[model samples]
Target chain A: MQRLIVWSLAGLILVPAAWAGGDKKNGNDKVFKIEGTLAKDDPADKLRKNPHKVHEYKMKAGANYVIDMITKNAQELDPYLRLEDSAGKNLAEDDDGGGFPNARIIFKAPKDDTYRIIATAFKGVGDYTLTVRVASEAQSILEQLKESLGTKQKELFKQFPAAKTEEARQKITDRFYELTADSLLPLSEFAQKYADDPAAKEAKNMVRNNLRQLEQSDSPGVGKVLRTLREKGPKEMHGQVSLALSQNLRSQYERSYQRKDKDAGKLLKEIEDLLKHVGENHADLASQVKDVQFTLKNLTVGRPAMEIEAEDLDTKTFKLSDYRGKVVVIDFWGHW
Target chain B: MYPHERSLVKRLENSPFALIGVNSDQDREKLKKTLEDEKITWRSFWNGPKGTGGPISAAWHVQSWPTIYVLDGDGVIRYRNVRGEAMDRAVDELLKELEAKKK
Candidate 1:
């Protein structure tokens, strides 16, 4: 059973890489699967508190379909979610983005058509699993993803040779853990890939010794920027300030989890306060702050639902719930 | 991705794609300067009490900077995790489907 489980896990990781290479459709477009999980299994490791994702799928016209999504917990914080067809019109939509730990948003697919799924987390921490399956459409993206992964893996080995040095090897191996240490099997598989390599073995030991360090590793290069903010305030590099702030908090949270510190709660509070403080003054940054807060709230354990109220530029007053019947996608963001 | 994600902001200013920007520069004057200098024409939404991120940030569940979601007319969620070429392709693809369905 253990070996079986290991094989299955290996398949999951290798499959995606395979599809990245061959298995191109008629259009030669790359395919990907929706299986597996994006968050840590412990539940404590998630800090999603923002709304920002646009999922799109193409389908044959006039087909019956359903979009399946899994939310880890239950909440009443409904965001606006919608589905629009290729012609720039809504086929089906709702005002609530919540109500989905594993939800199916059903719709009728027009002939030879494609659709986009739009949703905003109007209130709460966001740890969600989204899956789309249009049974009637002959084209299943999930199946395609699986097929693609099979082919891509072979190509990866062909083009990408093994790391040449301990430093170079450590980079890939370190990156793997730094990005996915919370993932038990992923960490294990990547380690096994280079089991024979001495550098890989050393790197794996380092990763094991500091597995928990993954959480603290959010700041790849922002440590200096974060310290600068602490000492000098937001006077310089204001644009990067927000990014550094998020990274700083992420690293701090990781550290707290590692040390089992008594100041965990206080640190979290300070981070929130700092975010709020940043939002209070930076009108443009305020949205970014809110979004980060929302993500933290959603993916955090034992958290309250978020409540958001916004005025649509065209409408008089728009409460997130008001768009309940339609799919509402709130882009509570802008780019620099 | 490599351009706005790779090249420089100046390149983005000259691209043909339409952009709706949210400036994070603390200084309004600086923000305005960047926009004017770059020849930006899209709408700008300032982060406010009800802006995208805030205590309400938890409300939207925004995990990172520069997030976007699309909804149907009745406000059902349709798509997410989009940016760069994926966003443009997805939007164009959806619009095409919507038009065909209507016809």
Candidate 2:
């Protein structure tokens, strides 16, 4: 069974690489195409430092467009796609949105104007096919939502790399959540309505991810959304949604309990019942269920910090318990 | 962050406060140079060759860089992921509490 699992996992990893060579359809709406090559030693501009090709296209206001830059023949080339208005204001930029290393941008044109589409290789030299098309009318709702959410996501991705401090990164992230706070209901509705659409899977993921972040930041919308999802979300989502809702409650209970709120006990009961329900009904998420339970019982605030004994920079032993009577800060830090 | 941390370490030099690190630099030798150049005086546990995926961070279930857990004098965790001024306040409060107990 273990060997079978390993092979299957390997197959899953290889699938996207295989698709790199295969022709991909940009949904069913064709508008225009540009084929270009980016070579090393090409002039670097203020907009993009990488070797790139630029094309200009006129876009209509309120129209949704799907832009894909897929590398041809060269698997080593990782394409980065960007869309900017004529004045060089960045509208949307993407890396790896078109599967493994390709780039896709779902953009909703804000005005009727000439837009510049810049195609560049993030790594290697390659010939790439850039396809621009209308986001099909049949999938208009999902496309519209994606374009709206994608803009903020693109901005975050663009700024995140240059963020020097944790505070700056948190500011960008908090802005994203603030911008998309109202998206949970609309996205959840989309996921439920289009249960079988490939994009629906993404929608569900966005909801889950946003919920997890909301829980962490203790956002006000978290409780309302969790309760709504638990009470009325799609049946297939019940298992995971219940788990998310329980986690939301657990965090709230932790806070209120810390403050000695009278409602803390009642909230704890609700959390326990929801967790038990998830465990009993969601066999597929068994491990995740156990993780939530473990965190609740062991890793919560006021619990004794877990002990650590390890080698320091010089291979000498270092232990957390050694500084027993001192207030300590364990910083899990890294530099890349 | 390093400059801020340097000042923080200096300020808390005489207090019962220790800021420990689990360093996730892939190259230990390079990190040794950085420690000296950056003037990092605190001791740091090596996170091994796997860097961010090393044993210590993996065991702590840390998903992001610079995950922080502030523990009180008795080694009970009191705060998490607090940074900058918030981290300073947490450490000060705990230190003050410890001093009161000593009296």
Candidate 3:
């Protein structure tokens, strides 16, 4: 039987936790390294959504800490993390904040107390490496913003499936844009005030992440949001913003072509102009610019299908052009 | 997908149409069994042992499975990822165009 373990981490809970064991010291900073496994027989959380393991740690008041749950195979062990007060109150939680399938939580202790850290698998089961360390003040603020964004994004994703009507879906999408804008507006201000700060790169990344979501959702407010970000956001991020806009426009062009819309060529021209601007201004994105132009020139509707010459299951080689006289459906398929 | 493809191939058996698959199954022997069991009668090019990461998919920049591209008799790409009823309609419309051109 095939092991269908690999799956997209999109919409999956991305979080992390640590164990009480293996406390190590790195200078004045207390470093804790915990290795653990989540199995099928593990206890599920209160909501019974995920199987988890819990650990307790003594935390100092007003101190910032960064916790990460790193798994060897993200496809098998999608880690989630939660920090709770001694009284079991949820302080903060994260999923995919450490990057897809891994989890990280940045927490500032409210008071001197023992805090419970919960390690769980969002899906599947495997081993993970959990580490905890004191975070610098600057890193903590940025990471906290990311954690909060992750939490809200998680909540919105949960509500997405239950949204039956188009109106409800649109409302949720609008809320996503609002949340993203709320988080970014402050960062944008900070970036402008401290123009030379290295944090601007991080700010750019946040914008890129939100733009990615916007592309997938195709929200009606996307154009307005993109305009606002381009005008108000850090100049360092303009390249990614342009790239995302061109990509979104490419999708629109494809859809228009599929529908046989008369105005499809207009969108193509817009995309071409956008890419040209990116190419001249964003030198780093030159290769990507070339790739987009190549696809536009060769792979668009009404273009000749690119020839594929490869061996079949029987080891007999054939060319796609061999079946030129027939109407063909080329399916890129996998059993899993 | 197999069932629908089977039906489409059968429905248009007499027409100048073909359904070609770039299959990303890792195990070729297992895929052969699946092909037989699923009664898949169309031609498929193997995407090699690396499965989805193989050369064909990389060249095509195909990010998802079951990504369909419909091409006309002149080998011009006409539609993409149109499935089920829409897939049938796209194919039928192209075949009709071919018929119209013959006249």
In terms of DockQ, the best-performing candidate is 2
Give one digit per residue, the lDDT tens place, for model 1 in A39-140: 222232112233535566765554445555554454643343457777757566543322433444566565665566654343444555555543432223
TM-score of chain A of each: 0.26, 0.70, 0.58
CAPRI quality band, candidate 3: medium
User: Please, what are the lDDT tens digits per residue for candidate 2 over residues A34-68?
Assistant: 77888887666346578877888767778778889
Candidate number that wins on lDDT, 1 or 2? 2
Q: Model 3 — TM-score against the truth?
A: 0.66
TM per candidate, chain B: 0.56, 0.96, 0.97
Best by TM-score: 2
User: Worst ten-residue run, lDDT, model 1 chain A?
Assistant: A39-48
Docking class of 2: medium
Models ranked on TM-score? 2, 3, 1
Model 3 lDDT per residue over A1-336, tens place:
133333324213221122222232322165777889988888887643788889888777777888899888887998889989899998888888787989998788889888899998777889999988777555666666777887997899899999997679878977786677567656666556645655556665666677666654334355556657767767877777777667666766777887789998998898899899999999999998888788777766767989899988777899999998889999999888
Question: What is the C-alpha DockQ of each candidate?
Answer: 0.12, 0.67, 0.65
Per-residue lDDT over B1-103 for candidate 1, one digit per residue giving the tens place of the 0 to 100 score: 3244323234334432223333333344445565565555444434444344444344454557666554433343334445666555544454454556557
* Cα deviation of A105, candidate 3, in Å: 2.2
